[model samples]
Target: MSRPEPLQPVYQFSSAQEPVSLRQGTVEVDFNNDRFCGMADLVLRFLPGPRLVFHAIVRSTSEPELPFFLNVPDNLSVSFNGQKMEGFRGRWKANGNTLEFDWIPRSQPVVLSDMQPKNSVAAIFHLFNFPEFRGGNYQEVAPLGCALLVLESEDWKISLQELPEDATREAWDQIKNEGGCFLTHMVKMERKDGEQFSGEDAQEQCFLLDNFLSFINGGRCWPVCGVGLDASGETTWETFASPRPVRPPYSWFNPYKASQAELLFPLFAKRWQQSAEWRDCLHSAIYWYVQANTSGGSPSIDAAIILAQAALERLAHHYLVVDQKVVSGKGRASDRLRMLFSACGIPNEIMDATPDIRRANGTFKKDTRWMDAPHAITDIRNSLVHPVSKKKLHDCHVDAWKLSLWYLELSVLALCGYDGTYVSRLTAKYVTDSANVPWGKKA
Candidate 1:
């Protein structure tokens, strides 16, 4: 395992990789063919951070004497390398003769073709911001339904089985720490003895794998693009963009290791198999969890705390009333949550373990108020939602937010039946080592 090259979030499939540059093109600047128009020597660069940069030298085409600025249209058509590209919704500015445009894609994922099936397909994709393995070698990480998932080396290359002599802690850091994409993994689905792999099955399984990885890594871990090869030798290219925010740099919450993939992913696969309803419930849960913890632009902590709490309540409802039939769903929120944690074998003293949260609770606790984790959390949440002129929001708002997220993460992992080691965000300031999950045998 030599030091891996840093990956840019943007790259072309061809030889001209990140910051893919194209020269010599034109822009259509008028609505009518014979009306006002402009041509430009265009340059487009697909830069890292998944950004697009457009630069052009403009000149009037319909009226040669007209100023270039006058000829430039508010909405222009783009063409580069003899190909017209659509969806260039960006702001354009002119500085003398040069016109420039820079744009970032929207946050939502854009899947070109909905789950079209392909029988017994092999899918190869590059992972974004994924961590390196301990051995720094090619490994089959997990299985998704009938599909086998393998984690390969960077740029679709397979590494030697043995770890490189120079492998170090620094080598295992995620690629997004710098920027760019690397580490191509594969999903191979084969037909069972007499069964046929449906056309859309491969894509469906890949996205399912994506959600699970994103949840475990506590960030946006998605395949930017991939190629699919069917058993019949038919090849197709799959392109999609999920431009969600990655994990916060300071977040210490359960940095999922490649080693846990085998143990955890199978459990997730089993959960997904339950029913469509179960899948929907899990997806909703993951969405809220990601929003609470990983949204960009300095998301509101008050809103995030509320989101985490709402997710925990939803999971508790599904697990207790809908799935397990353990509770009648008639109780105080904190009591219900206590029952939920008890059922999951999570310790109730998590607040005590996190010194920041504990100290925050002490600062505002009145007499016997906020005696424990659940009470403290709910009380803080109430303060945020139902404000009082005399009641000041806790200065430890971030601590409470993280505590709720910790609870939510544990609950979700337990729901998936995971019994692996996890780094506790609660006591991470003092204790940085990974520990067995609360319900795991060692714990």
Candidate 2:
């Protein structure tokens, strides 16, 4: 019988030596660089085509003496199962005191049926745990000719070798007693035809297969399992079932809004309801019309004028709401505003009036250089809702969009006889206090 050839070597560093021993089929390499500690593992598999995977990790012990130094090879070459991999490259990155290199093979379906079980399985496990070497230590024992023993504290333990026809019951009991956590890495070799070795014997069992080998090789824990349990303490392996859904807490009233509105509305309502700046601008243009239509100097006329002006100013603010939109296209701000006005009982003629009428009766303006806040707001809103124009938006310009939202909110409060200043204060408080909230998942 012809012996199976050893798997090919795919990675080697210029300043490193191969490991003194292998735990699984993997080989570790130690480099001479003071700035880095590195290792490599080799993985071999038979069925899905003969294959090899190599992984390495480099750690930085201290800052580099020179900004540019060659601690790693310029290029890497890998050969697997008699096939040469072209352009095989390794990647390295420095993270604080450590660097990592991942070298992937260029070819596919590299089989490993003929390789000896001890070397093949060991290499596969080493490749799987390549990612966790820095924070963890690996322990391995190689038996004379049959099996290899490997373990990592707080991680896992594994044994790889061909099983005997009569594996001792004591051996099985000892392994099971050792926490039933150790995984068996195995492969069976059989011939192709009748009177020849039947390959079916080599097929792996699903449960016996370590589903976490890839992650373990990558130096990470296995992902959460998806098994479900029933009340009887037995595994409830069902195809489909509805999960219990959680509902958010509900209340008859929104306490946060109620308390906030009550605390702020009365204090600033008058300023919002009747701003001197808005009244002065509108009174000059509409005073005569109001007097002619109603009794001059009547309090009712003044109140009516104020309500009408407040409504218009609120509408003007609404016309300028801006936000980031992923897709680009012309925004229908004008059409939407017209529809809103019609719904609010405002006539089309009033909606279509000249800027002067808007400025005099509402807070809109035509030509003024002193920062037309409403127009600036409208431009931002259009930019967000419409297609990105040739114009580039800066950080300050984005801030303007937020300001427009705040001001619009205030305008709404004012129209509703609530204090607008309270909205500003509450917004500032919420934003400041929210900074302490944790934002992302822990490692």
TM-scores for all candidates: the values are 0.67, 0.19
Alpha-carbon runs more than 4 Å astray in model 1: 1-17, 20-48, 51-88, 91-117, 135-199, 232-234, 242-257, 294-297, 325-331, 359-368, 389-393, 428-432
lDDT of 2 by residue, 99-198 (tens): 4555555543223233212111112211110111111111122222223222221212222232222222333443345322111223221122212211
Question: By TM-score, who's the top model here?
Answer: 1
**Candidate 1 clashing pairs?**
1-164, 7-179, 7-180, 7-181, 8-180, 9-180, 117-199, 117-200, 118-199
Q: Please estimate how well model 2 matches the true structure, expressed as its whole-model Cα lDDT.
A: 0.29
Model 1 lDDT vs. the true structure? 0.55
- For all the candidates, what are their Cα RMSDs to the real structure? 7.4, 27.3
Question: Global lDDT of each model?
Answer: 0.55, 0.29
Off by over 4 Å in 2: 1-259, 263-370, 420-443
Reference-based lDDT, residue 196, model 2: 20
lDDT per residue as tens, model 1, 317-420: 88888888988888777887888888888877645556666765566648754656777677778778877524454665777787888888888778888887
